[model samples]
Target chain A: MNVEFINPFLTSLLNVMSTMASMELEPGKPALKTDPIAKGDVSGLIGMVGPQTKGSLSITFERELILTTMQKMLGEEHEEIDDEVTDLVGEITNMVTGGAKNILSDKGYEFEMATPMVVTGKDHTISHKAKGKKIIMPFSSEFGTAFIEICFEH
Target chain B: MNVEFINPFLTSLLNVMSTMASMELEPGKPALKTDPIAKGDVSGLIGMVGPQTKGSLSITFERELILTTMQKMLGEEHEEIDDEVTDLVGEITNMVTGGAKNILSDKGYEFEMATPMVVTGKDHTISHKAKGKKIIMPFSSEFGTAFIEICFEH
Candidate 1:
């Protein structure tokens, strides 16, 4: 994937976490996705297509970390994956992706984004039809670890 | 949901099942989706975006039926949810949605489709960010029952 396409999403994720939950996230090494099972118990996925690129972006969070983030963002306690928790994750995904879209748009990478979809389970796999290597970026915070994946075909 | 947009999918589904697996499917009534838990153990989802429409189409199947269909489609005995089985479902989804797209395109609805995504689990939920009613079309075959869900924003 192009660095020009990757940076907007990375920047947006860091900004979203800092602004929404007041947490600082440290991004680790980026790698290609070879595992079939998703790294987290919950994931928010959005598909994007542009005049020059097409692919998907996913934010996956471990159960405990997501719950902790939710507790802080909602200013309440959440012990379970209720509707509110799921919605919060979805909203976060939308905001982060939205921020990325804005940045990419200014760079002349005109793209249309699909609605974010939330998939919940312990052992579930996501496979997109696009033929390309997917890039997975690992992030860690005080709450727990999460992954941001970007795959685009240009 | 407009009949103009729904019939093509139904027709394409029946055609795919009959042609690919030699199974005849009878579609039931279409209803609005309210339950968050997906109806089947395995599901094939494709997102569709057009000049005037934006939404998704999904075909979810019971495990047993998917297994049986794989057995017949591949002319072999398979008893597990292996990668091949998942790939078969993804292909079926792509074919069915491709058929529908062709019909819709002929009728002047130009749309771009994303690669199909498959989710497998005993009990799972799929939530889309698009704010609109989702139409669920239930179907029954000799093997088992399945669902075709369509949700779009005009």
Candidate 2:
């Protein structure tokens, strides 16, 4: 798997959310976090294909983190999570992928993305094809914890 | 203008419909024809980026075409076009782009896409911008007239 293929997407996602929500995100190391019930958990998954093989990008966040982020986006406090909130999260992932795709296009890598699917709940495991490497970048914000996962086969 | 990019997308769309609807689409040159008002005119647009400059792909159709397509998809005659019909057309565009992206990615072109936005009207003009090269593929089916436009800069 090309780490280069994954980095731009993660960076763009962070930049978009940070700008949209006006929330500060603390950057940390890229490593997979396996805890199912982590604080604010919202996950977005999108598949990609190109030179190498097919794979997916999954971004997960604790519930609280997403609520605060959504609050900032909608300018309203949300106590209960519903379709609107989930849709917003899915749209965010779609935008991030779009931004990343634009940048990668300049690098001579043309990648198309699938419509994003959003999943919310604890103890839900996302499985990717058992090839290549898994890279996870975890972030801590005033709102909550979030991570981006890239699974691909080189 | 790369006809290579355009041909695959159009073919994939026909292929998907053929497999799903069991209807054989006669291969013909891209041209213009008078379209009837079946259900209503529905259009969706989403932007793309990569080796080329900024551009968008749009899919439009009449209400009748949508109803017929949806009927094939759902295996039933729908009395009227509703939310499900609208979503099905939007999803068709998404799937077509997803397939095209796979080919582009393999060639090392990188870009992102915006969420699909649905629009309704009659005789709407769809535009594309690519290095000052603009091409519009107008289509007329049993339902109505629709087209896809690609514009980008090299």
Candidate 3:
């Protein structure tokens, strides 16, 4: 994976969490994802198609982090996953992907993004559309960990 | 839900299974999907973006059907979740969606399709991208059931 292609998404994820949910995320390391099972309880996934390249981006959130972030962003504490939680996660996924899409567009990688899908369940599965090594970037915060998986073929 | 928009997919699914894998599918009554938990062991999901409406289509197959279909299609059998199964499921997802896409395109609904994503696990979860009621069109075959989830915002 090229840093030029991937750095924008990492920066975008950090920025989205900070600005939207007031959650600061410290990125740990980038690794190749060998397993298809999700790392967290809930995930939002979006696919991207460009003139030359196409791929997918997904962000998985721990249960505690998702619930706690909901309290901060919506000012309401929710006990379980509902339309509200799914909506918030969907927005977060859209914002992160949209932010990176802009930078990539400016760099001449014009692309179109699909609507994001949100899934909530213990040990849920997510598989990217792109064919290649999918990279998992882990981030730590006060709540727990956020995993961003990116796959792009070049 | 408009039958005009969804009938193509149902017909295409039956045709795809019958022609591609020599499996005949009997579609059951269409109903709204209230549960996010997947109905089977493996699923393939694809998203669509169009001029007016956008949504997703997913095809899930039971383990026996997947294995049996693989045996018929590839002349191989005996497997847990593996690359071959996922690839075949992905191709089925693509073909079924593509078949309907062509019919829908002829009907004047131009759509750009995202590449399909394959997920395999016991009791997995699947969430569609579009808003509004998600419809599950179930089909029965010799092996087991195959569920087709369709959601499009109108």
TM-score of each: 0.90, 0.48, 0.90
What ranges in model 2 sit over 4 Å off? A32-40, B1-154
- Candidate 2: docking tier: incorrect
DockQ of all candidate complexes: 0.56, 0.03, 0.51
Off by over 4 Å in 3: A34-38, B34-38
What tens digits encode model 3's per-residue C-alpha lDDT throughout B34-137?
76755688888777777687777889888998899898877898678677788888788889888999998898887777777776667656677567778888
lDDT for B24 in candidate 2 is: 48
| Candidate 1 residue runs with Cα over 4 Å from true position | none
- TM-score quality measure for candidate 2: 0.48
B15 in model 1: Cα distance from truth in Å?
1.6
Q: Which structure among the candidates has the greatest DockQ? A: 1
Tens-digit lDDT string for candidate 3 (A1-154): 5888889999999998888789898998898887775568878877776767777788999888999989988898998877788888888988998999899889888777777777666765677756777888889988988899988865
Candidate 1 residue-wise lDDT, A1-154, digit = tens: 6788888999999999888888889999887776555557777877776778777777888888889888778787888777777788779888988899999899888877766677777755666556677778888987788888877777
Judged by DockQ cut-offs, the docking class of candidate 3 is medium
Error of 1 at A61 (Å): 2.1
Task: Give the Å shift of residue A143 in candidate 1.
Answer: 2.6
What residue pairs clash in candidate 1, if any at all?
Answer: none
Worst 10 residues of 2 chain A by lDDT: A32-41
Q: For candidate 3, what's the TM-score of chain A, rounded to 2 decimals?
A: 0.94
